[model samples]
Structure formats: structure tokens, C-alpha cells
Target: MIDLKACPLWLYRLLPFLRWWPNVTAHTFKADSVAALTGALIVLPQAVAFATIAGLPPEYGLYAAMVPAVVAALWGSSWHLVSGPTTAISIVVFAAISPLAEPGSPQFVTLVLTLTFLAGAIQLAMGLARLGGLVNFISHTVIIGFTAGAAILIAASQIKNFFGLDMPRGAHFHEVLIHFGSHLTDIQPWVATVGAATLAAGILARRYLPKLPYMIVAMVVGSVTAAVLNARLGQEATGILTVGALAASFPPLSMPDFSLTAIKQTIFPATIIAVLALTEAVAIARSVATRSDQRIDSNQEFVGQGLSNLAGSFFSGYASSGSFNRSGVNYASGAKTPLAAAMSALFLLLIVLLVAPLAAYLPVPSMAAILFIVAWSLIDFHHIGEIVKRHKRERVVLALTFVGTLVDLEKGIFLGILVSLLFYLYRTSQPSIRELVPDPAELRNPRRKFVAKTPDTATCPQMPILRVEGSIFFGAVEHVQRHFRNVDEADPDKKNLLITARAIGFIDLAGAEMLAKESNRRRKLGGNLYLVGVQPDFCEMLRRSGQVDTVGEDQIFRHKGEALQAIYPRLDNEICRRCTARIFDECHVALPDGTPRAVADQREAEAALARLHAQGATAS
Candidate 1:
């Protein structure tokens, strides 16, 4: 075994696969081989289906799943994440490039290759710049909603092929539904029968054979059913169509359109694709990592996905992203390392080369039926139900994202992210500010704990203890200022303010400046602001901002007890003599001016009160 710890940094940086290449052994190789074969079989149908969705020839999907998968497996951080053609990327490709040129034409394919290259370049740059944390801003609710919408779109797009309807190409989601409804009488019964058979076979295979690849099984059944029907009913009677045989050669070297016009048209779409691809890749990587008990590096994943797409564009493939189905299956099939993903691509290439001619037997309706199953599986019903049944705000995000996705695919995710952010900012802008007072009940207890101020609790009229429960930033400065103003407005005598800073999670320059201004204002009122249990970082911020001088360094204490001890002497003796709420230990001992109080009289008063309490209890 190679000692990775002793390996030089440059080697690891140049060839990241070196990190895990040392772990490959005979035992792991056998495990990975089993997983690779299973993944290869699974991707065969999905690749073709995704290609159909993207308006590309079916062979291009196989090409994408080969080179790109290998590149990403070797370069990425996750052990089980498999990169290939996915439904979202397929729809995005079709949506982005369909307007530029005729679908499946030479010009359309060139534009797609260019777009793939550009998106890969952008992803690579972002990874190099360490911007992988940007995906965190996109909430899980947004993903759930967007996925549900995309699933519906996927099903809608296949309706024409599934039922042999005369729906126009590249129709909108609602338009597809409308066309399907209008053409209900025109549906070919033979095509529908094939699709129904395929769907039923897929559902049954998945239910009975949990470890088998249901998609390939479904396709076989669908093809056999379609072939039998076409043979029995005759070609003229049955209007069933078959997907033509795919090319058998390896992926050829390709070039993207570099014309200025093509570049201009595709630039914006490329950016959208880059963001969407990275999000999908990282999310899938992390999801697989959770089950495998591995830590994923998001930045590394970004770089890996970028490199994979770049490789794909040069090798006769369209844009690709991480595939959740393959990755999940890779993990569930007992893959022990990233080698399984890399090897799956090789196996897929060999399998496709051998079976390319056999694709002629695969019915278009059968592929459509299999895709319907894939689409339904993508919709996470359990999570969606939980979001709707439990959280109100998250449900709003989920609904908006789902509806927006049905309207527009890319913008739906953006809208969901925007709503989630707005909700986050609104909540952060209003921090919880509470007034606390020392509990008279725990007066003699060793541990001092403060409780929320209530009518029954007697608090010092001159000094109010306040606790802030969130960060104080520019967005929250106004709220914090208003809170401070309300305190003085309600009780002018409460000039001395004791702020418990332990609860303040963060404080910015605006917060420190506000503290300085408040300190100056209190000084003018013949009082000062005291901070108790202040965090060291906040103290440093205050000192660096020059607010420590305004709110005297002596006023800042490490413990609430210390601050209370120092501020006790500053209260007025006349008020202490007349006060009945002996909230502090010092209040019971002497007057504020160090004058000895009648300790014997205080003890006698306490004894009398105890006797009254006992008599009241006896009466009850």
C-alpha cells in the first residue's frame, strides 16, 4: 500500500485520484466490477431516454455517459457519484439550444457542444475560485419543488411518443397537456398498449427483483410486445414506431462552433447551465456520500464536473451532470471506491458497441414508458408531503418552485432561491430582545440565574438587564436602536443599562458603532452601559472600533456577577432605603452609599414574613 500521508502535495494536486488509487485491491476490484456491470446496464436505457429528451440522437447519450463518467470519477471527491446525462440537463439542453437551430440538425448539435464547453469553463473557474459554498443558498425545499416540476415536464414531453399523438415538437408543459387532451381520439391503441405493457413490467420487476435493473427489463418486455403486435397486426395496421439502430463506433473527436453569432446566442444559457449543472452534481455527490459515510469536497466536485463536461464536448457528447439514479445504484450495489464509477463508463462503452444494432428493436413508446417510470421516481413524494403537512414557510417555497418550474424550468429554481433568501433576511432582521431580572427566589442560591421580567418579579427601577438573542448587523441596526429607545422611553430612571452579551452570536461594525453611540447617550444622562459575559471576539470588535473607550473598559465584565458588583455602588442611596424589592444580595446588606443598613431589622422582617406564609398555608 502506498503511504498517502508521505506523498508530496504536488502529486495529489495534479492527480487527485492518487488519493484513493492506493486503496484498490483484489477484494475491492471484485466488488467494483459487480457494481460497474449493474450501472452499465442501468445507464443504457436512461442514456437513450435522456438523449431523446434533449433532441439529440440516442448514440450521443451513450457517448456522454462514457468519457465524462470516467473523467469525473477519477477527478471528483465522492467515491460513488456517477456523472452522465440526466433529465434536468437534457431538458435544459433542449430548452436552451432548440431556438438557435433546428433540433437534431448539425447546427443545433454544434451549438450544444459549444454551450457544454462554455459551461464547463465557467464551472472550472468557480471551483478554482472556491465558490462552491454558493449552492448552500439554494434550499432543499427549492430542490424538492423543482424536481417535482421537472418530473411533470418529463412526463409531458413523452406523451407524444407514448401514445403516438400528433403533438408538435418543443411544446410547453401546458401546451403538451392541451395537445394530448385534444388528440385523445387520435391516440394509436397499439402504441399505447406497448407503453402500458412496458410500464407494468417495469413496476413489477422493481417490486419483485429489488436488486435487478428494472429499466432494461422494462425495455425488453416493451420491445417484445411491440414486435409481436407489429408482426400480428401488420405494419400498415399498427402505427408503432421504433427507435432506429444507433451508431456502433466509439465517440469521435468533435469541434464546437466558434462563430461570434453562436457564442453571443449561447453565452447566457451557458451560464444558467453551469450553475444548474454544478448544483445537481454537488447535491447528488453529497446525497450519496451520506449513505457511504464519506465526506465530500464540494469544490473538488465542481472541478470534476467541469472537467467531465469539457471532456464530453470534445468527444461527441452534449452537456452532462451527475446522475442520481446511477450514483444511488452504485452505492446500493456495494461499490467500495470511485473506481466503480470509472469502470462503469468503460463497461457501458463496450456494451453499447456490441448492442448498438439491437436498438432498432427498441420501440419509441417503450422508451417513453420507461421514462415515465423514471420521471415518477424522481418526484420525492414523501418529502413533499412532509413539507406541506408541517412547515408553512417551506411549503410556500415548495409550491412556488413547483408551479414556477412548470411555467419555466431555470427560472423556477431562481425564484425558489429568491423567496427562501427573502424569508431568511426577514427573520434575521428582527432579533429577539428580552428584558431579564435577577430571580428573587434564587437570591441565596450559589448559582445566579435570571428570569424574564414579570409583574410578580421585583426588578431594580434604575437598572434594567437586557439580553439580545441574535446577530447585530446592518440589517438589524434599526431594530436594535428602536429596542434601546423603547427602554429609555418607558422608564427614564433606567439610565444604567446592563446588556448580557452572551446571547449575541455576532456583531458587525454597525452594531459596534451603535453601541458607542448608546454609551455616549447614557453618559450624558449621568449613567453608563455595562456589558456582561461579552464574547472575546465582540470585545475585540468593540476595542478595534474604539467603542471600548466610550463604553468604558471597566464597564465590560467576564461574568454577570462581576458587573453586578461594580454597578451596585453607583445606585442612589435614597432609592435603596425606600425600595422594597431587595433583588440583590448587596441590597439586603447596606444602602448604596456604603451606609450600614439595619441588618437585625431586615432579619426580623424576613422571619415575620415566613410566619405569615406558614399561617396562610395552615388556613388553606
Candidate 2:
């Protein structure tokens, strides 16, 4: 046998499952099988509900849970993330493709397959390009808002079946509300009763039973309730509908339409799905990894998700992603490795084959109720409340994303990301520039600690020290320059500026040029700009940009005390003669010109008395 440890890095990357294959002993296998069974049972009702949300036949959802789930588990980096149909992806798929073709039609399925294939291609390309960190751009607030919006959409889409009203398919959120409002008189009592019964059963099961799968319980309850109602009042009296029997078979091979028109139609939506899927998958993977104490390779997860979708499209599965619920369940059920996720697909197939015929007894209204419960679970109310209460910018992003999603599902996330990025740029463009003074309490300390300058604090009139607490980049050049100009413009005597550069995170080319120019400008004003605690990266940037000479290499210091000692001897002696601030230790002994400060102290006392007399004269 080939020694796996001797394998090349590329081989491991190409087949990630090989890395974990060695861990599958009898104990792990047993644990994984148990977790797999639990995950499969939990996914049964969810997969069908998600497929219904995607406007695909119920079997397509089960198909998605099979092949894609196995493929993702094998290829992905996460040991616990279970890939399958999810609420957000399902809603997005329906919103995107329903407008292009009739929901649940042959043409619609074809378009969706094409969309899946294209999305997989994009994700694969991104993985190969190592752009896994691209998902970092999508802020958590955006996800919360978008998920909340999609949840509401899911409930709105189910209104027709829940209340037994005739509404147009794929109606926008507002339109759904309006249609529901106008058709209140047309509600069928028996159908509404079944939906309500199922909803109540789901809520009660979820709250009380806690251990059982609530969706399955609710479905059984609704199906039995509908059957009893139909038998009692005859089928003609009650307008309740059944989901009909699902096809019981392994996922069959399929082909996506590769026509130019199909490709053109799906390309843009495919890109959107690719990004959304990657973000969802990676976020879920990392979240699960945190608890599992596993290191997740985001690029590998991207490749896994891509390959799953690619494989899924050929196996009659639509777009799929990491399911938060299923992944959480898998982990909580004590899954040991990726094998658990793969085995779940097999367990699901066996479960589906047994239960496929029973689906004919499942009521449509019950499916709607199950979806309502799923949707309700999707809204993160605690996080939403925290965002609203804690941060104004996050609240704005949440509101805009939620509202925009209600308006247009596909573009809403993009809009939220754009707004959040703009806010981020605005913040980074104005770095904190605070004047600092030596701490009076730490005056004798050799380290020379500093504090922010307060109104009562006295400063050296000729030189002011400031601390910059953010990156100095092209976007912030104008703001930094303005601060530099304001220093001397407000008081021409304050011509010299010393910056504590330890807090500066970065300095780009534009920032380096700006610093060089500011240094020159200060020198022309009979003063100079100095920096202390300059970081190595900033120093390297200065050297690379050829601005070190202009900035005066000697002006850069390693310590605050050293900088102050060096700068003290460069101050104006004439100004120092009458100044009483005496903030520095050197001021106690001698002036910048090395003259004894005793004479300067006598002059300062006389100057103070003269200033008091002048103030009295002005008052008189």
C-alpha cells in the first residue's frame, strides 16, 4: 500500500478526505453512523420544505441532500458542516429563477440546473485563485438583515397554501400581503384548520418534546388531521391538497442546458449565488470549527462547495450550501469526522426510499406551516436587538439591508455590503489625531508616560505632540494634511509638530509622500516635523518611497524621552525666555541656547505680573 504520509501537498488538497481517512477506526465509525442517522432524520422534512421553497419538486430536495451532502463532506475542510438545501439559498433560487420561468415547470428546472452549474464553476475558479477571504467583505449585520428578510419572504410565499387563498405564484412580498388582505373572504376553513393544527403541533413539539424532529411530527399531525377532515366532510367540501407521492429512487444523472441563451441568462445570478453560497458555507464551517476545535481551510471549503454543486447539477440537484441547522445537529449529535456527513447522505437515501410513498398523505398546508416554523427560526432576534441597541452604523446597515431585501431579494445583500463598506471607508479616512502631554503623575518615571491633552493642560507653545491612531493611506491623506495645516494656521508659534507613531498601523505611498511634503512645509515655517516610536513597516515604507531624507531620518526617535531630549535643544530660546509652561525637565535647568533658566524664571514672573496689570487696565 502507498504510504499516505509521503503524499504530496497537492494530492492531499485534491482529495481532502484522504487526510481524515486514517482517523476512521471502529469507535469513530460507530459514532459517525449514529450522528449520520440523526442528521438524516432531521433533514427529511427540511429537505422537502426547502425544495418546495425553491419551486422545485419535493424529490429534488432529497436528491440535493444525497449527492451534494456526500461530495461536500468528502472534499470540504470542516468535519461537521453538513451541506444541503437551506432556507436562504432556496428563497434566493426561487426569487431569481421564478421570474425567468414558471415555478415548478420543466423550463424552470432547466434554468435552475444551468444556474447551479455556472455558480459551481465560479466557486471553483475562486477557490483555485485562493480568494477565500473575499467573504470577509460581507459583514455579519448584512447576513442577519438578509436572512431576516428572506425569512419574512418565506412566510409570505406560503400564505396562499396556509390560508387556502388563490394567489399568483412568485409574487413580491408586498404583493403577497395585498393579495392575502384582499382574499381574506376566500379563505377555506378546512385548509386553514389543518395548517393551524400543524403549526400548533410543530410549536408544541419543538417546545415540549425537544428531542424529536418537530417538522416530521407536524407533518404527520397535519396529514392525519387532513385525512380525518376529508373522510368526515367528503373531499369536495374541504379544499385541502396533498403534496402527492415522491419518486423513490437514487439520484439520476442529468445535464444542464449549455445553450448560449441559457448561459447568458444564468451567468449573473450564478455569480450572486456563488458568492452567497461561499459566504454561507465558510461562515458555517468556521462557526462549527470553533466548537469542534478544528482548523478550517476556507479555500478547501470553497472547492468542496463548488464541486458539490458541480456534482449536484449532474445528479438532478439544484444549488446547495452548508445548512446551519443540519450542521449544528450533526455536531450536537456527536459526529466524529467528515464521514458522518457523508454517511448522512446514504442514511437519507434509505429513509427517503422508505418514506417516499407516505408523502402522498402529506398535506400542502402542513408543508406551509413547517416552512413558517423554519422561517421563524431563521430570524436572529437577539442579535438584531443587540445591533439596534449598541451601534448606530450597524443599525443603519441592518435597516437598509432588511428594507432593500423586501424590495428586491437578489440586490439587497449587495446594497447592504456597499453601504457598510462606505461607512468603513468613512471611518478609516479620518484617523484619530489627538494631542498628548506628558503625564504629570508619571513625571519622574523613566518611561515618560503620556495622557491626552485636556483643557487645563499646558503645552509647549512652539511644539505640539500628537498621536495618530490609525492607518495613513491614500484615502486619509487629505485629512492628515488638514490637521498638519491647522496646527500652524491656528497658532503660527506652534510651527513644530511631533507625532507618536507607535499607534500607526500602516502607511502607504501617498501617506509617505504627504509626510515628506509636511516635513518640508514645517521647515519652511522655521520648525520641523518629528516622529517617535516609528514602526519598522512605516520606516521601510519611508525608505522605499525615497522620503526618508526629506522627513529627516534623525527626526525619527526610538523613545519618547529620547525624542523630547533631542527636540528640547532645537526650540526657540527667545520664546522660551518668557514661557512659564516649563513642561519639560530640560526647561528647569537651561534654555535651548544653554543659558541658565534662573534668568528666564525671573523674566517669566515679571511677565506674569505685567499680564495681570494689563488685564486690570483693560477692565478699567
Give the best candidate by TM-score: 2
Q: Candidate 2 clash total?
A: 0
Report lDDT (Cα) of residue 224, candidate 2. Answer: 95
- Which residue ranges in model 1 land beyond 4 Å of their true spot? 1-5, 439-441, 445-447, 452-456, 596-620
Q: Candidate 2 versus the native: TM-score?
A: 0.96
TM-score per candidate, in order?
0.92, 0.96
Q: Report every candidate's CA lDDT.
A: 0.88, 0.93
Query: On residues 280-325, what C-alpha lDDT tens digit does candidate 2 reach at each position?
Result: 9999999989998999898999999999999999999999999988
- Which pairs of residues collide in model 1? none
